[model samples]
Target: MDEQTGSPDMATGSDRIAGDNIAAYASSAHSPTSESMMSGGSRNRKRSEVFATHESPYFFPAHQLYNVVSMDRSTSYTLKLAAKIDRGFFLASNDWTCYRRNYFQISACFFIPGLDTTQQPEVPCLLDYNGELLQVNRFLICIGAQIQNGDKAIELVQHTPKRDKGPQITPKRMPVRAGGDLSPGPTGLQPYVVTYERVQFKTATANNGKRRAAQQYYQVHVDLFAETDTGAQILVANLLSAPLVVRGRSPGHYADNEDDDAVAAAAAAAAGAGAPSGPGTSSSTPYPADERYPPASSSYRNDSISSSNGGDYSYYPNYGYNSSSYPYQSLGSASHMATQDYREDYHYNNNSGRHDSESYPASPLSPSGPHPHAYMTPQVQHGFSPAASGAASPDMYSPSGFPENGGGHYQYGSPTYPQYPQQHPQDQHHHYHQEGQQQLNGQYDSYNGGQQYDQETQDHATQLAGLRIHSPVSPSSPLIGSPTGVTPRRQSFSSALSSKKAGVGIAGDRSSIGSTRKTRSISMSGITKRAPSKTRTSRTVPATPTKEHHSNGGALGSIGGVLGGIGGLGGIGHGVKGLGISSDRIPENPMEDQQS
Candidate 1:
């Protein structure tokens, strides 16, 4: 019940009587704020922490001293004993008291953090109860009872706690622990054994005007067993008195430990032996081991002791002793767990995709390479002019030490790896003659790998070859093709032959060429390959006729005219050969093409 409600009875029935015991409030004066309770934190500390640091506002520690509520000086209660251990033997007592001045009532019941009700680790108290017999019952439990010399006698009760407000004032009829069952009462007024002790909860000054001693009420603790010289003994010791009851217990094992079984077995064996016993104990003993369990009380045998330890392995914020006495909680919903796992997988898949460098953009710091460090390394053995070569500067080439594609930039099948040269427009026909000759002679394979050259690759190679043609026989020689418009030579034939011999690589007189027109055709059709240059030029300069020839070569002067007045190199070549002038060179017998 909520303490704020202040109902007439907060909790009714046995729940109230067994609600919070005196052990829950022994340190009520120093009770922690409601926030400090073990909702869930480092709550499963050692048991010593409970007694020292914990407190409840309305409970007293159990197994401690308790004071009687009221006592009457006018009445003197008498003590008595039971006749013998016999069933259906109706016996009454004048020993027990339920009268007003002798009986007590509870004023409050609230819990303090002390120990659990299960008594798992060890037995704790049942506090805030009245040991008073407010009503009479046939099965009276004589508290502080003893057995000696085959007779039962009542022992004196001891303890002194103040009479304070508690929860249950009447007799409590409930199990010792929350989940256990209560044994049935014997007769109409069957009572079970119980006792009480006292505990000091709080004591301080109270003042209406000036300071004064507080009119304080101490806590009372209830106990289930009493202590004796023989050993610790329960008040309601044995209740299985019937014969049929004995037969029922004969089959089942109640105790987990073999020790209890041995004790019971030993007692049974001792009784059955009956080796001529004494007169008073002469009657045959029945199932003497049939001892009744404490009614409405928890078992303190503690079968699972390992759970109570607060060691490093056992204690955690979520488990240990706290879990044993309280309800546990689940972590989260199923969907939430699935969502978290999916998020992790999503990130992993994306990362795995990027494991290939081709998936991402290139780095800005360094570029990929022909050589390992192509972008920045110097070229020490550059064999040709940059313009002629159609190559990037030496600084653009990579060093041998680095990867060909140093920056991981290029995708598969990049155009950068092949160094295809650019074509020079002026040299196309020149290279074409040489290329056709090679094709006829089966000299070199086509640069295009037997396939036709793509426009780009053809352009590059043509430009490179055109720049290299600085031949000894300069096409710019005046007599070869003059600006005076393809006129006959002014000098003698010997001078021309000597000049030709000195300027070109042929050995015999020019007359030997007359024997084979096919050989002449071969020479006219192709330019012989030149030897390699000793020192490469850096600048690329185009060779051949000047711009004037290119501009006027397209126009023909007449049918027999050789030099075209206008147009490109092709037009000029065709025009020169059409006339019987022998535009390239005259045969040794210059009269031959003239005679045709």
Candidate 2:
């Protein structure tokens, strides 16, 4: 779109370009500076810069986190856990205060194939955050709250995990370290009894990028169960009742060092005596083997917990502590004494279209490869360009890190593990200082006493700011006057008036029966009025072409600018002639309708 208009380019350009011949715009015969083709330094960067702004706002909103699952018609269920640390914290809350304070909401859109009609299933009171049954539906959930009526919404199917009784799969035991810290080898640990089922989403292909996008989601269903002593259960209840804490441990780390051989021997010994236990075996008291391993949460477990007394237990320091009368309290309950920890991991699909790869532009001062210290590393072969190859130049590397042969810029990598060329500390400081100065000078439009503007306004301002371009016309005389002796400003005013008159002419012309035939042909042809000649050349007394008039290549170049000369005039004239009309056909003076 023209920079002056605050609308999308397609909205404005569609009408003009659709009626005009597409071939005309697509033709390669036009000069380099023609407005039809995007060029010039600022014009090329505008689209890229706007895209960057949309993907990376000045600051991210707390509630704007999003995740997407791809599902097809064959899939009927999907399981999803909150990904972000802050998001997980809110979802793990039992008091519902997090929901109230943060206006927590999750939006999921499902589409299935071949389903004419379906009602949202009634939310069941099945499981609490602590892996216990709710017993009663007391939590306020806006069920089946909103559904889009289009083809995208009706075909969706989703399945949340249910709390159920299953055979408690217990881990084998190995030697327990002094403090449950498994060293390099031979630590006795047991696996917890947790089972997970697959969840799938089924929907018809609908509103994705194109015909290839499926309109459904699918996931594996999972249920986590653990048999615990009163101490461990109390600790589990505490974690479930409060905000989730990612303990910074890997998911597989806990089960890694368990003594599987010893646990197998123990299981064999128990089976010989007929290990009497039913499914969901926590009730059985035949043996006290459950306390051998701490009851920890797993991926299969619903990441929420709650207690019968749902008051503000989180605020109390000793809320999770077991009864003071218990004998183990003297040494602290096994739950409080264990070295158990919680850890959260953020995983994102880098292949998705919406992901941003770089947090900062490339550093101009760096000579390193994407790997840190790659330039100076002795392990890598010496491939640095020699000083004779112009390696010392800051502009040697393109922003994308390939040779600067005027190619397009490339993104560094995903935000999580960005592969950036190493930059010196001084370069980083310079970039930060430049950004700070821009903020101080009001370039960001977002630093007004620390208050934030609306997202829409910020987006609009960003687009506007990026649209600025360096004009080819000089400040001394910006307008290119017509060759027919009319002043440029007068011609512009006349053109504006002519545009208004064309509106009335079109309306009146459409109404008149006599003009219908001509109007129809004109409309179908989409004929535009011929514009005045834009070519002119400076003259000298000896009938010789002035040096200022004829630039390189025997063309009428620009009369005032660097390219100003007679060489440019020929190109412009040739372009004008190619439009199927001559300069003589243009009106000397445009007439406006008397209706004002």
Candidate 3:
């Protein structure tokens, strides 16, 4: 069904004729019953004067009415009607449209002019054309297309009610009061308020089952009629709502237009092409070959060789062996050559009964057979040949060659090679002992030199020891400072020697010779003695005499006295003692004294 009102061109001839009849009826003068009811006289009543005293029933303009009307659950209806009325009453307008599937309500208030401003302005009673008061119990509602300029009639389209058994036109009746009755009381003289409640439009406006134009418009026509005494219908008051623009059916109802066959065909093709094959089933079509990888040749697969004897195998064509510039003709020839070279250089001998053939079988490429010593042989021997022999041999110094040995080739440590002599354990011991003895003799020689140095040191030290002694006094001589001259006791030789060694003088005075005098003392014996101090008439016995004078005097007196006396040389002792006495008293020679 069309969503809008039908246009003039789209209407059939029958539809146009029907439209003309409707227009004529709507525009014609009031019917005989209506006129009689209004005038209470003849069926043809004269029209009212231009400035008539009585007021007429008419609809208010849309602008003068309240515009805030809405349908439940609808986003439409944002724009509403608003206008001024000449009667000074601001009434809601019914000059707008509504969408299909939406339930809406329309309300209009009727008022009689000439009413007191202080009293209720509502119409207390609806008067007929005859100036008689009448009650309007209900109104008839209908929907039809808007009249065009040249159109003589309005075309009404089919309408479906909301209920199965309800009238084909929704909201066919609208009661003026709740109980559909107007009692003869003050309450019954109520204000006239007409309302169409919860009205829904199921189908859009159309003509002859054709689609609607975008600008097509429809109107809701309301009519109130009263039954005369003769039972004729008299049109009392009627109103036409604003032009309505109805929309088409909702989008959810459009599924019925799709093509099921075409949809099924597309789904089948996609499934067959994209689905994977089952495990038990094989694909009928073989995989297409790609130009990127060419197929392998039969020779490449059959003659492929691998490095290991048994394992997972990967096949590749032998590339360089087939070329003429390659050194070895085949793999087997290369292996055999390496084996033969190893044998000849090392002197492999098969007489040891270890078969070389068993280790390395003959190569297919070398058809004559395996090399005689292609594999290792037990008892491999090595021999050294002189450079002048004119034979190709490995260099003895090379790391890979056999170790060099003198006396020709022989087993390790064998008697045949006698370059290194072997010694008995006892001889090794004796040899060690001789070396130790030589070291001891050297040590003894050094010790003897040290002894000679010590002897010289001791003799010098003895001379220094004598210098520390005081001149000895004779037993028959008087003490130098004694009062009675009672013959001073004689000190024994041992006591005199000890007194000198103890570093003390006979006069109880410490000698000027310090402890280090031993190191400074030098023996002047067997050497020319330094001349004695010049004799002075007033000889101040020199304090701490020169080291040379001290050594000569002390040595000659003390050591000579002891030696001479012990050797039975009394003259020598007397002369030495006199020299000691003279050195302290007068300068004289000990030899002169000895001669006297």
Candidate 4:
């Protein structure tokens, strides 16, 4: 110490040691401490000595440590992810079995252990391997195929970027009591759960070129990922469901590569053999187990095969049997023969009960043959059979048989049957003419017989004529007989005469007499008479003049008076003059002439 201040150096060294120990203690105190360690340390010390003594017990453990415990860096909590299907039990063995084109349900849940599940503890924030905060709250499910006893896996369906997005759970801040005040506690996020209620697979399990024993098995894979700044994904949590069996359209039947090969072979063979191939034929590609019998076509007549007689044999190739193998005769031999053969075959098949009743008629050769009621028409079903309808030949069966003028005419209306007699056209025409002439002669005789007058009718006619002559408007000629050549049963002539006599002295007498006289006149010179006045007027006539007698111009006055009388008589004279001249004539005013 005297050599290099030894005492002072020793003191400095001790103080440095103490200082390092104190620094170590302070550093250790400031370092992060676990809840359990902190609790143990607190038990060793007094409760009053703790920094947050007035804080609630709930705040002491979780709330007080909230700021100290970084959720992004904490390793105490771990996410336990799991995936399960609702209908995982198979009907046969309680194992999972999925059928193609069917729906199923899948559910996934991720939670932390050692937490009250009922409390719905939040899914704590996570950090990836790089220590970067993970910001993913959703997960996706993928359907993959795994071959039995195989090492490799095949993905059938994968999640898309945006369209196949998953569901997310939002974080919520829970309230808690700290000391004497209410404050926001740790964020609360319910368990991360998502459900795919109607998950369906359109494709069946594929063998992926593996052995038949190594059939396909399906699995549902759930993945959680966080997006990076470059839009890349970082895997966080992943889970896989149990293996399941996916079946094909036929239950319990698994299709493999061998079946596909067999189908391809059949299709190639059909194409080489010139068999019809289309949607219609492809639908029936599933052949039956029995190889001896071919699959039936949708119809008996396909569009490919045809006969020389405009018939259909298209179904022959469609029967899946070789057409050349059948024992059929040449179709060009005869149309009737070919039809008969077809009918026989149809009947044979029907008799064997191999075909349904609706396939064809009961019998094509029925006694009534194929009438309008059945499917086949009469023209196609049967030829002319004389025994059926008692006809001589095909010509005799003709609906219009033969013309009337022809020699061998078959008349339906003829009383005789089978044997129709021939008749001459000239004779028939003559017969019709005779009937018409007889009718005309009868009509003429009726007309002449009706015109003849009987004696009694003639006597009535004379009386009617005499009465007509006395009538003011006498008829031009004597009465003729009635059209029916009948005499009046009630003597209507007498009644007519009495009616004329009663009308003789009426005011219409002069016009009636003039009209009657004019009807017999040959000349048109007839005077029109004026009607008499209501008050009758009298007129005086002078004496006639003599040739030797003369008295103070009395003869001239008599001549003038005679002329005036003649002028006054013009109305009556003119009416008389309208008639033809007669040998005997009546004088006008006969009573006055006799007096003179």
* Best first by lDDT, ranked: 4, 3, 1, 2
Write one digit per residue (lDDT tens) for candidate 2, span 505-563: 32224434554332211111001111001111010000111221122212111111100
After superposition, which runs of candidate 4 have C-alpha atoms over 4 Å from their true positions? 1-72, 88-95, 114-124, 130-192, 206-212, 227-232, 252-596
Model-by-model lDDT, in order?
0.15, 0.14, 0.19, 0.21
Judged by lDDT relative to the true structure, which candidate is superior, 1 or 2? 1
Candidate 2: C-alpha lDDT: 0.14
- Count of clashing residue pairs in every prediction: 40, 58, 13, 2
Off by over 4 Å in 2: 1-49, 56-125, 129-131, 135-596
- Taking every candidate in turn, the Cα RMSD to the unseen true structure, in Å, is 61.2, 35.0, 81.4, 67.2
**Residue 49 error for model 1, in Å?**
12
Best by lDDT: 4
Q: State the lDDT of candidate 3 residue by residue for 124-218, as single tens digits.
A: 23323233333322221111222211011232221112223222222221112111100011111111222222334445432201221123333
Candidate 4 lDDT over 458-489, as tens digits, reads 23322221010011000110011101110100
Best by TM-score: 4
